[model samples]
Target: MRFISRTSSDGVTEQLFILGEIPGVLWTPEDAAGARPLILMGHGGGQHKKAPGIVARARRFVTEGGFAVVAVDAPNHGDRPKTEEFAEVVARLRAGMAAGEDVAPHLATMHTFLAGHAVPEWQAVLTAVQELDVVGAGPVGYFGMSMGCGLGVPFVAAEPRVRAAVLGLLGVDGLAEAAARVTVPVRFLLQWDDDKVPRAQGLALFDALGSADKTLHANPGDHGEIPEFETGSSLRFFARHLG
Candidate 1:
C-alpha cells in the first residue's frame, strides 16, 4: 500500500496504499521517530482493510498509546476476491458437528490462507517500513484477533523482529515454539463465551508457551466484542511492553 492521504487528529492523517497484487490502505502518522512502538494488525475472517472500526482502533494507538499501526485486509476478505468455494467448505464443516467440537477445518483453512498470503504481505510491509526508515525501524508489536491471532503467532516467532504480542480473541496455536524462541512479551485474552473459538485450544497454548513474560486473561464476551473484552487489554499490553 502506498501513502495516499490523511488528516486525523494526534498527527495521524497520512494514508498510504499498500500495493499488493492485493492492495490495502496504510493509515499511519508521518513520524520519522522509530521511538514509537507499532502494532501490525491482521484482519478477521470475511473482513477487509476497510472493515468497521479498524481505523478507529488505529487512531487510538496513534493518539493515545503513542504507537504506529499497520493493518491489512487478509486474502479473500476485504477488497479481495470472495472465494465462495471456501465458504461452502466452511458450511460443510459446520454441518458435520461432533461432540465437544465446532468448526476446526475452517480454521485449518485459515492457517493455510494466511501462510500463503497474509503473512507474506505482513512480512513485506515490515520490510517496507524498515526501508523507509518509518518510525526509525523500531521493534514492532503484533495484534491478531480471531483467525488473525492464529496467523500472528507464527509471524511473531518467524519474524524475530516483533517485540511484543497481543493475541486477541482467538485462542492459541503454534505458539509454544514461538514463545520459547521469542524473548518478546506475549499477552492472550480468551473470552469465555466465544462460540466459534474453542476454549481448550487457548488453554493448551497458554500451557505450552515458555516465555517468561506470558499472560492469559479470561473475560466474559463472545467473538464479536471489540476494544472492550480484549482489545483494550491488548492495547494496555502493547503499552506496557512495546512502549
Candidate 2:
C-alpha cells in the first residue's frame, strides 16, 4: 500500500491509500494506536469510496465511535476502471427494458457476475488493510447497503473477522444463500417504499439471515431517502456490538 493523500480535521485523520489497483480511504481517530476496532464500509452502486455519505460515516466511526474505518471502490464503481462486461450488462439490460422485454433474467445475470467479483475484492481489501497494522486484531464490523449489501452478504459470511454488520437497501433473491450463512449480529435497514427493491424481498433477505441477534429498522421512504435517524441508529448498533 502507498499513501495518496492525508487530511485531518476535528481530531480525526483521513488518509487515502492505494493498493495496486484498489484505492480506498482510511479514517483514524487522533492519538489512535494498535489494534483499534475496525469498520469496513461498502459504497452503493455508482458511488465511490470517497462519496460524501461514505466519508461522513467514516468520520463518525473514527471520531465519535472510536473505530478505524476503511472503504474501497467496488468493481465498476468509484475510481476503478469499469469492465466491458459490466458496461455491456448495463446496456443490454437497458435495451431489453426499452424493448418492453422482461429484464429479470438480465438482472440476475448481472447480479451473479458482480457478486462473483465483489466478495473476493472485499476479501482482498480486508487482507490489505489488516497488513497495514493500523487496526490491530480487534473486532471487525461492516456497514453497507444496496449493491454493498448485495456483496456484503457473502463477504460477511466468508470473512470470519467481521463480527457484526449493518446491511440493507437490497433484495433477497441472489443474496439469500449467503445471508443464510451470516451468523454475525446484524442491524438491517429497509425502506418501505423502495422502488428499486421490493419490500417483500428486503424482508425476505432479513429473514434469511442466520444471525440469532438481528434487528430490522423499517422506515417509510424510497431507496435513496434513508433517514438520518436510521444512520444514527446504525452508529449506535455498531458501537454496541463492535466497540
Candidate 3:
C-alpha cells in the first residue's frame, strides 16, 4: 500500500492510499496506536470512497468507537476507469429505469458483476490495512447499505476476519445464497416504503440471513431516508459483537 496524503482534524486523521489498483481512504483517531477494532464501510451505488455519508460515518466510528475505518472506490468507480462491459450494463439499467420497468433484475445483474471484483478487493484491503502499526490485526466489522449491502453480503460471507456487520436497504434477488452463508452477527436495516427496493424484498433478504444472531430494524422511510438514530444503534451493535 502506498499512501498518497495524510490530513488531521477534529481529533480524527484521514489517510489516502493506493493499494494495487484500488484507491481508498483510512480514518482513525489522531495519534492512534495499537490494535483497534476496524470498520470497513461501503458506499452506495454511484458514490465514491469519500462520499459525504461514508466520511461522516467513518469519522464518527473513529472518534466515538476508537476504531479504524476504511473505504475504497469500487472497480469502475471514482478514480478507476470504467470498463466497456460495465458501461453497457449501466446503460441497460438506466434505460430500464427511465421506462419505469421493474429494474430489480438489472440491479441484480449489476450487483453480481460488481461483487465478483469487490469481494476479493475488500479481502485484500483488509489484509493490507491490518498490517499497519496503527491498525493492527483485530476484529473487523462492516457497515454498508443499498449497493453497499448488495456487495457486502458476498464479502462478509467469504471473509473470516469480519466479526459482525450492519447491512440493509437491499433485496434478496441475487444475494440470497451469499446471505445464507453469512453467520456473523448482523443488524439489517429496512426502509418500510423504499421506492427503489421493495419492502417485501428487503424483508426477504433479512429472513434469508443464516446468522443465528441477527436483528432487523425497520422504519417508515424511503431508500435514502434512514432515521439518524439508527447510526447510534449500529455503533452499539458493532461494540457488542466486535469488541
Candidate 4:
C-alpha cells in the first residue's frame, strides 16, 4: 500500500492510500503507534470509501474505541474505473429500477458480481493494512450495511481474520450460503419498514447466520434510516469482541 496524502484534525489522522488498484483511506488516532484492533468498513452501493457516513463512523471508532479504521472503494465505485461487464450489469439494474421492476434480482446480480472481486480485494487489503505499525495483526472487525453487507457477508465468511461484524440491510437471496458460513459474532441490523428488502427476507438472512453469538436489532424505518443509537451499539460490540 502506498500512501498518497495524510491530514489530521480533531485528534484523528486520515491517510489516503492506493493498494494496487484499490483506493482506500485509513483513520487512526493522531500520532498513534503499535498494533491496535482494526475495523474495515465497506460503504453502501453508489458510495465511496470516504462517504460522509463512513467517515463519521470511522472517526467515532478511532476516538471512542481507540481503534484503527480503514475503508476501500469497491470496484466500479469511487476512483476505480468500471469494467465493461460491471457497467452492463449496472445499466440493467438502472433500467429495472426505472421501469419499476422488482430490483431484488438486479441487486442480487450486482452484489454477486461485486463480491466475486471484493472478497479477494478485502483479503489483500487486510493483509497489507495489518503490516503497518500503526495497525498491526490484532483482532479485526467489519462494518457494512446494505450493499456493504451484501459484499461483507462473503468476505467475512472467507476471512478468518475477522472476529466480528456489523451487517444487515440485506436479504438471503444470493447470500444464504455464505451467511451460513460466517461463524463470527454478528450484530445484524434490520429495518422493520424497509421497502428495498422485505422484513421476512431480512429476518431470514439473520436466521441463516451460523454464529452462535448473533443479535438482531430491528427498528421501524426505511432501508437507509437506521437509528443513530445503533452506531454506539456497534462500537460497543466491536470493543467487546475485538479488545
Candidate 5:
C-alpha cells in the first residue's frame, strides 16, 4: 500500500491510499494512537470512495465515534477501469429494456459478477490495511447500502474479521445465500418505498441473515431518500458492537 496524499483538519486526518489496483481513503483521528476499531465503508453503485455520504460517515466514525474508517471503490466503479464483463452486462440490460424484455435476470447476473470480484478486492484491501501501523488493529465493521449491500453481504460472509455490519437497500436474489453466511451482528436499513427493490424481497433478504442479532430500520422514502437520523443510529450501532 502507498500513501498518495494526506489532509488533516478538525482533529481528523484523511489520507488517500493505493493498494496496487485498489484506491481508497482512510480517515483517523489525529490524536488516536495504537490499535482502534475500524469501519469499512462501501459506497452505492455509480458512486466512488469519495462520495459525500461515504466521506461524512468516515469523518463521523473517526472524529465522533473514535474509530478508523476506510472506503474503496468497487470493481468497475470510481477509479477502477471498467471490465469487459461489466460493459457487456450494461449493454445487455440496455438492449433488453429497449426490447421490452424482463431485465431482472440480467440485473441479477450483473450483481453476481460484480460481487464475485468485489469480495476478494475487499479482502485484499483489508489485508493490506492491516499491515499499516497507522491503522493498528482492533475490531472491524462494515457499512453500506444498495450496491454496497449486494456486494457487502458476500464480503462480510467470507471475512471473519468483520464483527458488525450495516446493510440494506438491496434485493435478495444474489444476496440471500451470502446473507445466510453472515453471522455478525447487523443493522439492516430499508427505504420502505424503494422503487428498485420490492418490499417483500427486502424483507426476505433481512430474514436470510444468519446473525441472531440483527435489526431492521425501515423508513418511508425512495432509494436515495434515506433519513438522516439513521446515520446517527448506525454510528451508535458500530460503537456499541466495535468500540
Candidate 6:
C-alpha cells in the first residue's frame, strides 16, 4: 500500500515514500554520507501530510533552513487507512476537549502511535543523516505544528538527542506540559487569531517553559495562513542554541 519515488537535486537524492502503513510522504535523503540534524514534521487532526501549508513548510526546512525533514502522517490521516485504534483515540480526545475533561490520557495514546510508527520511517531518514555527522550535523530536532505540538513534545522530551524544538498552533495543556519538560531551547510560533487553539494557549506555553531561553513569536494571521517562512526566527533560535 506504499508508493515510493526518488527525487534528486545537486547530488542529493531523497526517497519520498507514500507510506501505506502510516499514510504520509516519508521523505528521506539518500547518499547523505554523514550525520545531519533531523526535523520530524507533524500535521493537525483530520489533516494529511499533503496539506499545502505543511508541505511548504517542509520545503522551507530543506531549501532554506538546510535540514533533513521527515514529514509524518498520523494515524487515520492522509493516504493511510483508518483503524479502530486511531478512531478511538480521536473520539476520546474530541470528547475530552468538548467536555473540558483532562485529555492528557488520549494525548498519550496518540504519542505512542506516532513514536511506534517512527521506527521504520526514521530508519530511512537516519541512514542519510548519520553519515553526514562526520562533517558536523549534530543531534536532531523536532518541528511540529498543530497536533504536532502533542507528538513532538513527548518525543523530544523522551529522547535526549533532541537539541532544538519548534511548535505551531499548540494547545494550552499539551504545550505547557511539554514546555516544562523540554530541557532544550524551544520556539513557539503562535497565531494571535487562531480560532482552533487560541493565542492564549501559545502564550501560556511560552510562559510555562522552565528553559532559560524560550521564545514566543506572535503574528496577525489565524491558524490557517501563517506568513511563509515564519520559522526564520525559529531557525535562528536553533542556531544560537543548538549550534
How many clashes in each candidate?
A: 14, 1, 0, 0, 0, 11
**Segments in model 1 whose C-alpha atoms lie over 4 Å from true places:** 9-11, 29-35, 83-101, 172-183, 226-232
Q: Per-residue CA lDDT of candidate 1, range 1-243, in tens?
A: 466665555677545465665565555564535445767877676676766667767776776677777776776677667678767755655665544455655576556655566667788887775555455577688877777776776677778778888775654444456545555688877767777777787676666665688888877667775435355667777888766
Q: Model 4 residue 155 lDDT?
A: 97
Candidate 2 residues lying further than 4 Å off, grouped into runs, are: 96-108
The residue-level lDDT of candidate 5 at 214 comes to: 99
Candidates 2 and 6 compared: the better one by TM-score is 2
The C-alpha local distance difference test score for the whole of candidate 4 amounts to 0.96
How does each model score on TM-score?
0.82, 0.93, 0.99, 0.98, 0.95, 0.74
lDDT of 4 by residue, 1-243 (tens): 999999999999999999999999999999998999999999999999999999999999999999999999998999999899999999999999999997888998999999999999999999999999999999999999999999999999999999999999998888889999999999999999998998999999999999999999999989989988999999999999999
Worst 10-residue stretch by lDDT in candidate 1? 26-35
Considering summed lDDT, which 10 consecutive residues are worst modelled in model 4?
A: 100-109
Best by lDDT: 4
Against the unseen true structure, what C-alpha lDDT does each candidate score?
Answer: 0.68, 0.85, 0.94, 0.96, 0.88, 0.64
TM-score between model 6 and native: 0.74
lDDT, candidate 6, 74-166, per-residue tens: 656676777788787778889988998755556656656755665445444434444444224476777777677766666666666667788
Ten-residue segment with the worst summed lDDT in candidate 2?
A: 102-111
Shift of residue 236 alpha carbon in model 2, Å = 1.5
Candidate 3 lDDT tens digits, 1-243: 999999999999999999999999999999998999999999999999999989988888888889899999988888899999999999999999999998888999999999999999999999999999998988999999999999999999999999999999999999999999999999999999999999899999999999999999999989999998898789989988988
Candidate 1's TM-score: 0.82
lDDT, candidate 6, equals 0.64
Across 39-114, the per-residue lDDT of candidate 5 in tens digits comes to 8999997899999989987887787888889999888999999978799998997898789775556667777889
Q: Report the lDDT of model 2 for residue 52.
A: 93
Superposed on all Cα atoms, the candidates' RMSDs to the truth, in angstroms, are: 3.2, 1.8, 0.6, 0.8, 1.5, 4.6
